[model samples]
Target chain A: MTKENNKVTVSRRSVLKGAAATTGAALGAGALGGFPTIWAQNIKNVTLRQFGTGVSNLNDVATKVKEDLGFTLKMTALDSDSVAQRAATQPKSFDIADIEYWICKKVWGAGNLQAMDTSKIKNYDKIAGTFRSGKLTPESEIAQGTAPHTVGFVEGPGSKKFADNESGWMTLIPTIYNADTLGIRPDLIKRPITSWTELLNPEFKGKASILDIPSIGIMDAAMVVEAMGEITYGDKGNMTKEEIDKTIAIFIEAKKAGQFRAFWKTFDESINLMASGEVVIQSMWSPAITAVRSKGIPCVYQPLKEGYRSWGGGLGLSANLSGLELEAAYEYINWYLSGWVGGYLMRQGYYSAVPETSKKFMTEDEWGYWFEGKAAKGEIKTPTGKVLEKAGAVRDGGSFYERMGAVACWNSVMDENKHMVRKWNELIAA
Target chain B: MNNTISPEKTSWMLVSPLAFILGLFLVLPILIIIMVSFWDYNEYNFFPAFISENYDYLLTSKVTLDTYLKTFKFMILVWFFCTFIGFTVAYFLAFHVRTLPMQIALFLLCTIPFWTSNIIRMISWIPFLGRNGIANSTLISAGIIDQPLEWLLFSDFAVVLAFVHLFSLFMVVPVFNTMMRIDKSLIEAARDAGASGFQILTNVIIPLSKPGIMIGSIFVVTLVMGDFITVRFMSGGQSTSVGRVISNEIGLLQYPAAAASAVVLLITVLIMITIMMRFVDIRKEL
Candidate 1:
């Protein structure tokens, strides 16, 4: 009996030592694994290059790709148009592109991006059905354009071709999406600003700013034009030449009268404009509005009665992708849609493509707080674990589905995008 | 003489490395831009075909003309301010300071801000100029005004001020170099001949400082002409510059149009420089 007891104690001690050794090995591997050149000697390696705009949280997803698939994902951050320019003119520079829907349409027109095989994406069927379905609110129904999230596929293969089956292909995979609205400083405005026309209201003269980006800025102006009882666009996304001219003329008239304090060209500029009280109101991204609030400014990303201008970003395979590069690119896409990436992006005010899958990585409270718009059960933190919300703080737009599902119009590349850019330049010059 | 290489050949050898660098980086890119300016582009793609549509549209547009006038307006205003400030500071340092160490120290003080990022320096003015900023608050406390100054932050004044702050150093460096090189004997002779301070400055100093002023003018004029960020940020986007138009066009992926605008800007700047150059032989002076 004494010998048996001694043997049992020895086994228990050895098991504990083994567990400690494994943990230490994992920690060392993680540190050394960051160096691709050293690891490439022992492992079969592929470098998956990517170009994108507004994909900062993807650094974590790159780590996931390295651990799961033994590949190095190199991402280059660029502006929206730069990404399109590179994808269209130099598709060989990158294997994957994180681009907007309209950009994909533009690049796809140039036969630069390949159709994504959805069969390889394990979470394809589990992606939010509402996003894929073409159903729209009554406002959108009358608006007579596809919903922002309705990314249609061509049911085939190759660059331009696509398919909408379980095994079908698409030009891009839906990833991060959000609803955007005007961020307003209520303390300065000192009144309710419910309508988009308020962006142009003379009362706010020299206290309003808009984005300098032509494609997105024109849409915001179009919303204001309609809200101000001017002629409404048939489709705000793909406005006709007449519609664009009419909207730009309104903007030019307003600009001449000093309707804007500044035209912000970047996220930080927009935030600084509001935070420093340079502008009382401006078209702002959700994250920027959050940043301003974090600065202790009385800012609100208001849900205008005209509804939010929504947009989404997705991933596309470059036409130059082949062999191991192609296989690794697909693997990265699958891993990006996995639960952890979705959860990570959700904490940053973006809705994940596959919410059900993302829920696996998040607590029930996090789901309720982020998606259901419930008050935080405990302290809620950002992806990097900075305290974003204290207990009992509620989300701004109520629920993710309610906010994203009711988008008025998606940011688009209009049919008259070139003419629109000229008009936009004229407005700025004026 | 028969065995020795010609002066031209020796000079060419010395300049070849510099010529190669200039040709590779500068002349080649400018030529490519000129070439691309004539290319045709649609919404998505640019085609490498010779066409005058971009230049035609740019040259014909009223907006382009107005934008050029605005840019020229900014350039003239900024140049005047920078030259005046730069000359005063340089004169104080070069002549009045007297001690070499103090002059060098003050000169270094002027350039210390340049060691940091230009963007940071540009943005550091925001808090100072904002409506509720330190300047306004100080003024308000002093009973200088009842209301916070609105124009202090986001108007033409702010744009000019930011430019003078940034480009004044360019003027100072060149003007100071020339002032330091001016013969002290000449100024003493003018004073001995019963010249007043004003007379000495106007006749002896100003005439001798022409090369420095011309060089300083070149730097200031070119910098303000090429600048868009200061105007874009400081003027609250109410102002537009020629460079801003090119940048905007590029951002919109209108490469051909941007190239055309760039070509026009380059020609305009070159003409201005040539006119300035006629005022003083900068190469001969250097």
Candidate 2:
């Protein structure tokens, strides 16, 4: 194994050296008119393989990258769990990893990714405060759980340890995030649903669902338990063994009562559960709500009085990346934040990290409807040009500021994650 | 050197390829799983450490026993339905169908659903079994029910329904094979001895069909015992199976725990198959 690894290292070093020599020659050749000759020649050969959850690892993004950036951008989409597993265990298989903040907490310890220099980011200052300081506004209190800013930075370029405050080096370049809430069928329920406690309300018994992914599911359960005045957790993100026990206990009791109609693990499952009217209310993502709406259902991403459980995803460069390949990765990250991808994702109900840049790529009316929470001036369309909402329809959970500012917690990986997982299995068994 | 090879040596040469393939693909992987089952794991990575904690926890946990019992319940229910349905269908095809072409055509008709993906076939049930689905609406319109039956989907009933739907074919093919190969002389002989139709079926046909029944039972038992997706998808993630437990642990990156659960499940399945093997000598029957 050691010999094979050494041989691979030697071959990789030689490849990097050869690429560096070509880059030097290209730099000496310099800019021709306004366009660089490097993009037409050397950079076209650079294929960066990226993998992430199905939400963001889009075919359109890869197409747009080929069109605009002049490189082969290969993308593979997996579920969140598989993404984490691949990022940690098979780091050499990918050049870039688009992963969530909570997943970052798990994958970062593997040291498969190199820390990114924030100075290289063109739109660093324009990025949202939620990713930089765990705040949407100046007065915003940082919510519990693995908020993006907490694991957003490393101490230095080569450091494996996460810094408490922002350092120059970042673990992931902030790309897209959203404040998530439960999706409910407003037409079916025929009543105003509010509060996390509604997830356990007996009226919706056998007509409610929750996500089955243990880490994120536990946070949703924590939100419900706290809302029901059952337990006051010190920090929902970093729960103690006792807190984990209590939270699982509450959900198990509910499960015994047949409170949940189902538990979904994928985006489609949530959409189907709502559209079929099999489930009246459940934990859901922003895009899933849009998907249900696209099917002409009256699905609402209902905001509760408690607040939203938020999560953020970003791009991380592999540790093996170097030479021209590394430069192309940085360019890709810059282009990602530069507006087009941001605009595309935002239209799908996700918030762009560099919101100001994203605003440039969207129409005033589109921007107003999606981010400003204003009623649609006309028929609102998705990035694909499919009509999302008719005129006078308002975005659910209101404006970006209002929704993100009310974030009560973020998806987390607790210290007692193993214990929590075991208890979660027991909940399923029950 | 001998002019001709010995029969024993020729048999070994022929079997070596199969033995080598099984050792590489099947035995090696199982050995690796057993090794990994003893290793230790944390939140992110599993390291190479000889620790029995994974097995220790799995053996002691109440959830493991409950999950096993639940999996067994599903296996038993699915097996019973698949065997009964498969036997009836095969019996029909073997005895009642006069023409060989008609039997083949009808048998092929049963396989039309398998052409599409398993996931697609499984998911298609959602529209038919959902709360406001066809089954519910049809029942309501007929004045047979007032409210939609919630148990039609995302329930234990749905899980068993899907299992029987997907796997009865596994049972059918083998039973049909064995039944078709049975001699007509035995049935005629029983009828000549003044045996009634039911008596001939019980005394002659069933006795001859034991090998086929055993083969079908084994197929249904193994398939249902190891299923996770059917239980997860059909039951709407409410039900737990042994396979689901292993998969859940794997999803969390807990390889050791998953491997430990897998080892236990494999041993349980092997023991069940062994007990089943005692009922009939499959090799001799074949």
Candidate 3:
């Protein structure tokens, strides 16, 4: 029996070896310019568990990941809170996590995530310089020391150079980002809307909606309040208790007067609300606006005069990860920052961190349509190449630099977050 | 003594696995929740503490009372509709249908909706009840109304409709199980005693189906009271239940506050169940 078992095991190992060799040969002749030498180290059979959201094209990216990286990349998609829950309680269960930068401080404080070694990530230097500094444009810079990406870099022992505060590490690697503005049905609203205050305008009463999530939703309210000349916040991202109260009071009044048609919490809900004409205008993600337009609804992602409320998402290594698994993780992160994934995400209405890398993978027409804000040179397709735009359609908000450069607050987790949540609930309940 | 000891030991051995499972999965989690409810939490994270501020805040807040009252309002409304519908359906299946095969087939037909996802089934109401949905368009085209009915969806009416649609099945199964076991002779005897059809139903059928009604009520009340998703989506975020408040708190990482709210909800549900148990001893019938 033992001799027969040994024989079977040997045969299976040989079969796997043959399969690996054939795959390697295929990769050598394929589009990726063959397997890089660094991957030749026997990192096979290592499974890097990724706890993340499919906010980007991770599903499409997963199929190519195993073949390209020579290791299994298993991804488990979770909502933000559930991701935090798993990261805090079972840090060892995953090798890496993809999370929003707004929530990074809390997650890092919980000791679930660790800073990535920038030197190890080959495309780290390729990340847009604007992210490193808080500048949207040369002249219009976000106040110094307020850049979202700088929040997680701790300068301490065992750190690298240029790491502010404590070391040579980063909280997370910027993956996909975008500036968000409201999506509205241009055909329904007879007049033009230029300010965020229009969300609560009595004329659009019973036809406007906002997001139901508190952390993000309150910022939209703050913008409206600020635009209305109700009150100006010192820093909209991190509001104090009084700021939250004053903002929420406006929302409650609006809610009481039936200014909102609905408060949506999910992507599809917002799309359905706009597409069904249940709401004429609402705070929406860009993809959701595109989704509505694809369904033959006349929805436009309106560029408000007050600028866009931007949010960013990125990948972080787990605190417990090290050795071969860690190396494999580093490889995976580099692979993400490499041209393919970045290009894929950019095509899906997100701005990739390494713009140059993404540009290498995009067709000139695709680049013109997406980044240059020009009319499409041809029918624009998504990452999988299903047509998303006709030849004449111009992208909203113009070029990447123009759209992202507009000064506005990012999604935040404030010190008064608890009070904000309470007040926000009252607004919803009202 | 030896004989008694041996049988007792055998019985304990038989029950030990289940007891262990209940202790580990059920009892331990509740104990942890109760323990955590007294802890302290800030914006970033929660910490273990002996403070009762979480409970204090929950008990004193006006929002807590409003949420509980709203949840109870929904619970009572859904319970009324589900019980009325469930009992009537169960009655028809048990009494009106004479053949067993026909009864089984009809019962199976009632359960066909369960084969699909609950979330899908719940959201399907959107197209059916939306402003541009089938119901409104049909009404307009037929000249029944000038404008589409706004209250058909994303209203209190929609929330109740969704709860009834999702949880009516929970009401049906238990009531049907209890009804199937009710003796037919009781109804026949009541009729023979010169009782009218309504009289027979009241005097014999309903009395014997007490356990079923009680059981179904427990299922329905608990399901509606504990539900947050259906109310959230169906009401278009205008409504808040006790459970929704707990979820919102948990979303904000206010674990202590959430745990405290959950404990209150649990205690409230237990009290309701205890009162319901007085109506009929469900365990005896089962």
Which candidate's lDDT is highest? 2
Q: Write the per-residue lDDT of candidate 1 for residues A1-430, one digit (tens) a residue.
A: 6675345434533543453455456557785454333333322335667778855435777787778777667778886767778877887788788888777766677777887777888888777653455443333342223343434465567635433433366667888878888889999988888889999989999889999877778888888999998977789988898988899899889888888888887777788899988899899988787677766677888878888887777888888776445766776788888877889888777888888888988888889998999999998877776677779988877898678766788778776778888888888888
Q: Candidate order by DockQ, highest to lowest?
A: 2, 3, 1
Instruction: Tell me which residue pairs clash in candidate 2.
Output: none
Please give the ranking of all candidate structures by TM-score, highest first, separated by commas. 2, 3, 1
- Residue-wise C-alpha lDDT for candidate 2, range A1-430, written one tens digit per residue: 6685345434654655665676676666873342345444557667789999889989999999989988778899887888889998998899999999888889898889999998999888888988887778889899999999999999998887999887879999989999898889999889998899999999999999999999899999999999999999999999999999999999999999999999999888888888878898999999888888887888999989999999999999999998678889999999999999989989999999998888989988889999999999999988888789999989988898999888999998988888999999999999
Docking class of 1: medium
Model 3's number of clashes is: 9
Docking class of 3: medium
**Candidate 3 residue runs with Cα over 4 Å from true position:** A1-41, A143-146, A157-167, B1-18, B283-286
lDDT for each residue of candidate 3 in A105-215, tens digit (9 for 90 to 100): 656677767777778879876787555655555676673113565564756423322254324478778888888998889999978888998999899887889998787
- Listed in order, each prediction's TM-score against the native is 0.88, 0.94, 0.90
DockQ of 2: 0.71
lDDT of each: 0.80, 0.90, 0.81
State the DockQ, from 0 to 1, for candidate 1: 0.56
As for candidate 1, its clashing pairs are A154-A162, A155-A162, A155-A163, A156-A162, A156-A163
Residue A82, candidate 2: alpha-carbon lDDT? 83
* Candidate 1 lDDT over residue span B1-286, tens digit each: 5799889999999999999999999999999999999998876678899999999999999889999999888889989988899999999999999998999999999999899887778878888999889999999999999988888987888888888888899999989999999999999999999999999999988888889988999999998889888888888777888998988887666789999999999999999999999989988887
User: Clashes per prediction?
Assistant: 5, 0, 9
Choose 1 or 2, whichever is better by lDDT.
2
